[model samples]
Target: MAVNLNDDLEFVDDDYFDMFEFEDEGFEVNRLRREGNSAGPDDVEDASKQKSDTSALEYRKGKDMQGIPWERLNYTRDKYREMRLKQYKNFQNLSRPHHGLEKECKQVKSGSRFYDFQSNTRLVKSTIVHFQLRNLLWATSKHDVYTVQNYSVMHWSSLLQRGQEVLNVAGQIAPTQKYHGSSPRPLSRVQISTMAVKDNLMVAGGFQGEVICKYLNQSGVAFCTNLTDSDNAITNAVDIYQPSNGSTRVMTANNDSYVRVFDVERFVLLNRFPHSWSVNNTSVSPDGKLLAVLGDSTECLVADPQTGKAIGSLKGHFDYSFASAWHPDGRILATGNQDKTCRLWDIRNPSQSVAVLKGRMGAIRGLKFSSDGRFMAMAEPADFVHICDATSDYYCTQEIDLFGEIAGISFSLDSEALFVGVADRTYGSLLEFNRRNQFHFLDSFF
Candidate 1:
């Protein structure tokens, strides 16, 4: 005797798409299997009869699925929308088309808010970025372009009559400009690594953004009014240095995996060298022909400036690179990294660091060759700065009183002065070294 079991397997549950709860149907199947109410392995042999039974079952799946508990599904899509909007609000507000104030700060007037910082000894009170009322021969220029003026207000009575025409060191200074009051599209990027400020021309670059140039010497007559983005871009402008090509040629390295050169005047795309991973910074050779790019990927790249072609890529830094500079002679490159050390390399065989300068606990952030190339100053985020001789590859001398993380540094063109920009809990100021070989605080320019 054959017992017919025809209506147990069908797919018509209304809440089928909601796989959240399948418990009710699971219980039904178990009960039927245990009580012998549904087909077992023996039911498939008679295919013709099974077809009729399967059709009847298809029409009754909901009947079997009824009374299943409907648990509510949980998920919301609004929280993500709120986060993205807040991240982009501040940039939108500050970028509301230039309000046309002073335009770009061009010629900083001698005594106005727009002149050079007069480091005169006569200034009864010395302030950072400015001198006091009676002492300032020329006020610091609000314009980013600085004037080369060396004058002493107190010695005027003696030198003023000695058959001498007043010398404005900036008599030959000229701004790099394309047109008058030319404003281009503003960019999303604000901070840039390298800034080339000469005469009245200022060019800056940032990570994965366009290269930008500003004309700041128009006195009140501003030229490039807006920051225009360029096609030849960088990742972070992580490291910026200029070669002495006699023209303002800015070399930049970005985290975006490349080193680029920008022609400031035309704002032209000069050259690009591909560097994968994060490039720490770039150092231009003394001859202005070679550039050394230290990579966070553990390598140093030496390349020809004119060709954007790599002479070689060498691996030396044990860990991610943090800082680097060119030797005074241009044949050697030096690199610092998160590994807590600095290393010297030969451009020809950059794969190996010839010497290691060690001591810092944190990654190095600042490195600069002294004006005479006799020494290189290596700085970390700590309170002290390290000084190493160009000839000796070790930490020969140290200055312990330096404070905060050394964020940036430079030597005066004359090599007679060293300038350091530091970063601490609050905004920091500069440290100065003068001809008297005396070290002092640079009047903070803020």
Candidate 2:
């Protein structure tokens, strides 16, 4: 029940729109125009200055945070949203009734702006390799962000307003460090499907079941390996975390119906947990005792990390789930589904979800909880990201409406900055938002 982008298949859906092709055409047109109108030194300098001015981290009172000029585009915001909803097709592996999903959803209270939009910059363009995957972006700090752009993993520094290439997977890359039990073969042109960066270590999963690891402080890739030899192999998600034993580890969910764990230091396999369905995503609890496994089934399982024993099962979703996250307190768990809803469950109760949050127009592809456990963010497939207040039982929320497919979402370690990746060729950029706290008063004093 997993979708393989490597297959060449025919489609029959009425609303099937080639959005990626459209975006590519737009990018080509822009490139040709820029080449035709070659500017002199003065014009080039002025253009560069203009781009810098727009890309800076500035907050204007009445301007749109996304820099989308709806009035001048000959279409209103509402009309564009209507068109998207009518044309957008949600991908599903299982046939089910989707029209009745709204009946089970709870309407979230709107107009609570806990985070203010700080900037929208086109300098750092984020690209998506697979449309169904949205786990490519990560923020190591408030000023540092990493995302996929074509074949490169790019690092963008908000403080300096510049970008640098962290790792280029376009060329042949072989692991420099050799492990005893791991196969060391040169991998070329790996199509990365998902990635995670934490505590100076970055790990990326590929469409061909390759796991690539690199240290930010080091020069080259530390380790690389292919997890499976199956034809339908795809690494769906990668989670980098520390266990209770204080050892760093990496967990990956794959389309092979296995959740594989690897020791970070030795780059060796630690454990492999088999599931009934193709595992889409996995998140370990804060205490590192419990694991949440979600995939092609409507029911999600709570399992043990060390042993592959099922602790409990949560059932409420009518469609497959693609994303999961644990609150810092390790009590509440959130899972995003193709049913256009994100369900929050209390692990202690495990009977039903405590809250059912609905999306605006599409599937909830990504979810993240702030480090302080104060806010939870849910991202749709495109054009919507919702921030829910954790203290208010998730009733109060703020909706961030934008244009483009979301590559991913991440919160800084300090819970001060939120970064969203937009993957459209024309409107592709990284969006940053800052928490609305009283600490900004100190900025004026400085």
Candidate 3:
């Protein structure tokens, strides 16, 4: 009657009790008493059969898990092998050059083998003897190039080696005979500020805000008009917009804080828009819908070309911007600043610049993009002209040293040659450089 409970519980299996053990282990006998009262011999036998069936299923599952997936593993291995094979083929193709490519490369290397890389000099065919060359305009026909200097227009043939001056038109034309009655005052000399040419029509802007039009082949003037009433008006820049199916329009930026548009063929004023500050430079977008303008302010503005309404503003430069150029595609703009940097802006996102190009010496006085948008030339106040490869995200840069002030820069319509106008009095000359292709990787053979 006094037997220990631990000895009486020896009928329970240790492993079976261990499976049910928890940290707060305690036994309640109410469920076991109820089950013992309700259970019969047939119910106990059925419970034993269910337990046997569950154990058989668990054993089958474990056996299945022990086997490997041969088909799936084969597929993965085949895919990896195929990828490696492709990589090997690509490497073979790149390692060896083809017959045609090898021949072409040999020809190129032999033809340019004698090229003087150290000197980097070409024969000087033409020398523009004019001093203070302010602007250059290349005609559409590609036969004539125009330059402005000292209130005179000099026409030169593009094919001329010596650049023989074809025609020289002075700023003033004398009257044939003095009038007997009271005669009008003779025209004063025009200090040319800007020039533009399209087809055979040439237009020049004067320091006194005069726009003069002349025919490339004719002698006398075609039309002339004063764009401003002030006696000391300065025309900062002139641009010609020739739409596909419309008349040509002349756009002029003036020191009087206004941009004027005129019909060149009709000789009539079209529209004039006023600005808060003096407009230093203006460039019409390629589509002729927008105008990129640099002014006395630190920020550049884009405006409607026809109405002169301000559309947007690009702000990044710390000093006043004096020059601007548009990519041929018309989506990008380059603004030259007095801070010695040219900021390139994406018109789609006018909030910030896409890149900032720095120069060596003074303020950027001139900026021009090649007609094909392959190269961009930025001229500083003196001694430095930077030619950037626009097609390369502006990574490749070529500098030209002329040892003088840079008046302006122009590229031939085909972009095969570049012309830089040096403004120094003693060394004033026009420089021509033919663009040469470079094979930089071949240097390793040395």
Compared with the true structure, all predictions reach lDDT values of 0.42, 0.82, 0.58
* TM-score of every model versus the real structure: 0.51, 0.89, 0.64
Candidate 1 accuracy as lDDT: 0.42
RMSD of 1: 30.7
Task: Give the per-residue lDDT of model 3 (tens digit) for 216-269.
Answer: 667666666677777446677788886444768878888788888877655567
Q: After superposition, how far is residue 350 of candidate 1 from its true place, in Å?
A: 3.6
The weakest ten consecutive residues by lDDT in model 2 span 8-17
Candidate 2 shows a clash count of: 0
Model 1 misses residue 434 by how many Å? Answer: 3.9
Worst 10 residues of 3 by lDDT: 114-123
lDDT of 1 by residue, 1-446 (tens): 00112222111122212323333323434554567756564443232122211121232332111122323223222332243233321111012232321232112112111111222111011111100000011112221112111220111211121112122111122223344333334343222333334344444443224445444433321122122234433333322345665776655555456666656555445676776665546767777878666664656677777776778877644566656777777777777665556677777666566666664344555676765677676665444456665554442454433323343445555555444443322212334333333232243321
Worst 10 residues of 1 by lDDT: 127-136
lDDT of 1 at 269: 50
**Rank by lDDT (best first):** 2, 3, 1
Q: For model 1, what is the alpha-carbon lDDT of residue 49?
A: 24
Better of 1 and 2 by lDDT: 2
